[model samples]
Target: MSTAIAATSEIRFVLDHVAQIGHLAQSERFAAASDDVIEAIIEGAATFATEVWAPLNHAGDTVGAKWTEQGVVLPDRYPEAYRAYVEGGWGTIGVPEEHGGQGLPFTLQTAVLELLGTANPGFALCPTLTVGAIEALVHHGTPEQQAKFLPQLATGAWTGTMNLTEPQAGSDVGALRAQAVPRGDGTWSIKGTKIFISFGDHDLADNIVHLVLARTPDAPAGTRGISLFLVPKFRLDKEGHLGAFNDVKVVSIEHKLGLHASPTCVLSFGDNDDCVGELIGPEHGGMRAMFTMMNNARLNVGLQGVQIGEAATRKAVTYALERVQSARSGATDRKPVRIADHPDVRRMLMRMAAQTQAARALVYYAAAQVDRTTLGDAAARERLEILTPLAKAHATDLGNEIASIGVQVHGGMGYVEETGAAQYFRDARITPIYEGTNGIQAADLVGRKLGMGNGSAFASLIADMRETSQTAALTELIDVCDETGRRLAGADADDRLAASYPFLTMLSVAVCGWLMEAQGRAASDDDLWQAKKATTAFYLNQIVPEALGLAAAARASSAELYAVDPALLLA
Candidate 1:
């Protein structure tokens, strides 16, 4: 059989496997969310994303949001689409009960985001930031702050923006200089300029609540001095109504390479000395507070990678099935069969399918980790903390690769806007750049995740690998896992991180490989399972070794990057 047919057949096998896992079933939050409501929500989200959002995706990138002296102006359709989102109650998914949210698990939230991002990445930014803001307040905000903000944010009455990056401090949060001065009346006056704030200024909602990071007068230098504060565009009265303009203004907006419909803004706080803000958490702990939201944002970004990958993969698969090219050896007629029947095309599509599925599985597992930590019974929380960064970084990196391959499969069509593959590629590019950057995530893995409990966390990771590999159902996966685990033993932090990373990558591949097989074995149709089994073998034999190489590198010291000089990086 041709690779295209084999790959599609493989994808069907993978979905069948996923469905049996009961991912779409009503979660523990069902009672609070309402009976049959979760299914309705999923069905509605899937339809809206596929129908409404997908159509505007190309247009959003082409037209983008306009930046002017007045403010940022998005493409015409965003407002209506956002309204539909609110009408569907999507904005309230995964929120707390007291705040009018449905309070669903991260799994449900993951499903929603996957569909939404696949539909439109630019559009997804609005709620992504809103949820991030809601999380910060709910977790670290004072009760008054939570009472004031969560309900509106939960209901999508207003949207939220995360203000972290500044011109001098893109990746380094310690370099931040935004200042917050305490006012005797319990509020603070915040003065800062935040650049690259997503959904910074939008007409999608009544107000934009900014979670700002700033320093205080008596604070220590560096990250230790920074604190998080809430700055709303319009001041809220004691009764929670819109009061007056709070000195927060959009200085300008950025014109970017992708995600045009999502307004990226440069925000100036306290330009007129009237920016009133409320503190979140404690003094000199802004980074700690922000980490919660940042972590969530990273996972969401990873999902975007999957979303774009799936979109591009679906498009490529369609084209491969319908577009007839040059006839090959097996062709009896002068005319070519679908390119999907071509060996090379099948290879490309299979590669795309495998990588995309791996990304999805890794990210979803991470979502499960997070849910276990957040809502799972107490025992699972600690392990979830250790696994979170791996999920976020690996999934996103895979997302970018998957989207890139998606374009390649489309051949020349992927490059052109008309084919829409390029949009997926363009949008997927941002995943590794934002949400704390993939490099930073790796560093976190080394510095914090592995180092936690004096390397006990890493030890636990090894134990998990051992247990996973011991499963007879996952023999191929276990072999990959065992090999990777053996390679990662006795490495320093940086090397361990590097090794662990690719090891994690390999682990994801092996896990998905096994998942595909296990799912294929139970498949109702023999032909589909045969195809799936082939792809599974291909992934294990071919791709799992790349992860092994990373493990080999991880077994090495940081001498590679460190031994090189700053000038040597130059061509």
Candidate 2:
């Protein structure tokens, strides 16, 4: 099996048919993204991801990144990869023309990044975080700030990192203790210790911009007190020239199960009380400003699931075709055939392929809504709020599931690291945990998102789903989704929280089923779209039924959950 699978045709199908990215091109903001241009961009990205990025995956995991006294050192080839990515203008996709980018639709940017990640997820983190940072600054930064930093970041000459987590605060951002004090010279002194910072301190870029969340003197307590700051690894002068050390240091990097080349670092700022940072937004609106970046990362994180699913499913399918094991049960000759010929193997493979494709559909659809929202579509913004969590939670969850099934399909070879099937599993384990726990995503969905527009946004979503749910299986699943949404709305907090995960699965599967059915109807019968049609059918026939079982769990009370004593449960 090849190290990478771009899924180019599949992605373009979603962008063109399901996501309907051509609508973006109709708008002046994305006029440059003509079909021919988009196709060429995707083709070029596929080649870069395949030729430049894919080969780095195994070594990124095996040799990994190192934390030396000098800084974080990547394996020798990693620098060449980063430089190629920068010079190719890969990072500037979707950024405005004025910001020194290609000025394409965000839909295209997402499609291209998905290809890169599908090629090399471990090494892809650097560019991914940088993309998120660019978005944050664009939305919240002052004109001066954008003037100084946006161009370099847009070009990927300098990378970026989000510094929100600390030893004391992981999911609970309110408990953070990072501090920033006015230096009386316009700049502020930021001092904090950040943990679990991805691509935190790397030698790959010329300079790293650390977006830190900290508090100031006499601010209100809890989340309300927090402020967002831009602290660079090296101080920048008026002309954006690199200067002094700025006292930011990478104290250590975590040794992890996977993604070794993407350093998760323990960073200390203002160790000598000289770190200078400029505020990005309002004084006490750190959470609000950070959400700009977090939301971008969340969608991209979900795409990580799509990326891994594509890679894992391709690997599994490749191995199944080659690894001949058993004779056909009904065969008279008793000749050994490829495992792909076996009924059970076919079942697993179809499930993997269908679920993976369903996830890609959801991600692209959500990405399209993002493009529409930018064009002042109110409905799109509301739908995007609801779709973001589903995309992040469900896709990443499927990434883990599909990657595990990839291992299962490989049987004995899947367990051994030498065959490299296990690496996909190990790498996928972090997606659901890192962005925000999928459980948290579920809670947010039920707690706040469902309540948007007094339930009108969700109702609108259901109406859209009903339009595409022509098949009985999809029709039934979407109806369950509507009924379940109403049921959860009226349920008590405990019941809602208890059923959150199951409810998330129920609704997410319903949405995916709708998309697949819709895509299947419009897909051409050529060899290129055969996989799409087959997977769409498999998902509706086999996977859509899972929604029924999930609905029952979603409707179940929170009683049994609270029945067990918390301490005793752990003990």
Candidate 3:
């Protein structure tokens, strides 16, 4: 059986044909990124991912991260793998040129990230957070802050993290109690404990640049009063030299169900009352600044789903081809054949293939829109806003579902960890929960994104989907869009909120269907293209029709949901 995680040809096909990434290369912003250069970069990334990171995935999962008095200790291979990643300049691909980066298109970076996540998601988390931190600083940081942090972060000399969640606040940023007291000097003394801080402490880099959310002493209550702070693990002097410890410590690391190699730390700031931090943006502007990072992280997390699904699908296909099973119903020979020949097995495999490909197309398309925004397309920016939550929620949900099916494909052996199929399922389970839960994403789609410009953005998106083609799936999508628009327009906030999840799900399915159909129409006569066409057909015929039921559920009233008594549910 093949050990390959993803096919390079397929990635190239999607980039060129489905996402139309050439337009990015032609843009003045990314004029230096030619087709040859992009191809070479992708090939190099694939080599590093498959050769270096892929080998450590199982070991990292098994050994996980250990905590001692000193700090969180990762598996031995982690440091070496991360070092290779940095040395190869993988972290600088999408950063701006002024920051000592390669300045490639974000769409290209997204492609490379898919490879990294597939190879080892646990390892991928470190750089993923760093990239988000880089983005936040590039957009919102002061000149001094950018000068001090961007080079190190872009080159992976030091890693980065976002500190948001606290014991009192999980998803509700308004409830956080972290305090930032203004010191006599320009800096502020940060004091608080942050939970679920990914890569908060690690042995992989010289310092960890923590972008934390805290409240100022004179600020108002709730999220409106919060401010963003940049607190490094070690203090830096005027010359950008590392100085004394910043009084930030990791109290412990969480033993999680998956992505165990990535340390989720309980971080205490100013335990010794010496954790000084600089303001990232304006005072009382933390939410907006943090959203810049969170939005980027959300898109990356959504891609995580697609990555894991593709990896799991590859593994399942390989196993099915190797594992011997019963013959077909009208077999003349008594000997058993490969499980791939079985009808039920084929059904599962096709579902996995179609969903994974569809999710990839959806994510890559969104990334292209982000690139378009960089070229000053306001409409593309709005489209990205609407697509963000849908991509995150839908892709991650599919990742979990497809990984579960991968386990089933491996049958009894999949239950045993030695087969490696169980690992994909475990790793994918966290994508939907983190970077804002899928439930929150659904609500954001309904309550926020859909309502943008008095519902014009969503209406325009639906119109674009309708223009793609008039297949049954496309028609269903149009119907759902119209129905959702009507329901949301007529109902109060409560009714719309109740229908949010289903509406998001329905919308995602329709968008995926439209992209797949577009792929089908553009495919050539090549074998891979033919396979893509078949997968697109399967999605439209078998999978996409499910959106109709989702639309129905989304259009339903919230009365039944409210009718159930919470106390009686336990009985």
Quantify all predictions' global Cα lDDT against the true fold: 0.72, 0.90, 0.90
Stretches of candidate 3 exceeding 4 Å from the true structure: none
Query: Which lDDT value does model 1 have at 493?
Result: 62
Query: Clash totals for all models, in order?
Result: 2, 0, 0
Off by over 4 Å in 1: 1-36, 468-504, 507-538, 562-571
Question: Any runs in candidate 2 off by more than 4 Å, and if so which?
Answer: 567-571
**Candidate 1 residue-wise lDDT, 1-571, digit = tens:** 1111112233223332543224433455434444255456566777778667777776788888877766677787777887888888887888878777877766667777777877788888888888888888888998888888898898787898888889999888889889899899989999989999998887778888999999999788878899998899999987999999898888887867788878888898998988999889998889999988987887788777777777777778888888888887666777867888889889888887767766776666666666656644453555556556666677677767877887887788778888777777777777777887777776666566655666665566556555544334345445655554554454566666666555556555555554444543465555545645565556656666555555455455667768878897895
lDDT at 242, model 1: 97
lDDT of 1: 0.72
Model 3 residue 86 CA deviation (Å) reads 0.4
Q: What TM-score do all the candidates reach, one by one?
A: 0.89, 0.98, 0.98
Summing lDDT over every window of 10 consecutive residues in candidate 1, give the lowest-scoring window: 1-10
Say what the RMSD of model 1 is: 4.0
Give the alpha carbon lDDT tens digit for every residue of 1-571 in model 3.
4354567777887888767888788877898788898899889888999999999988889998888888888998789889999999999999999997988888888999999988888889999999999999999999999999999999898999999999988899899999999898889999999999999998989899999999999799999999999999999988999999999999999989999889999999999999999999999999999999999999999999988899999999999999998877798987899999999999999999999998898899898888899899999999999999988999999999999999999999999999989999999999999989999998888778887888888888888888766687668667777778666866788888889888888888888998888888888997768889899899988887877777767877888788989888999
Which run of 10 residues does model 2 get worst, by summed lDDT? 1-10
Error of 3 at 92 (Å): 0.5
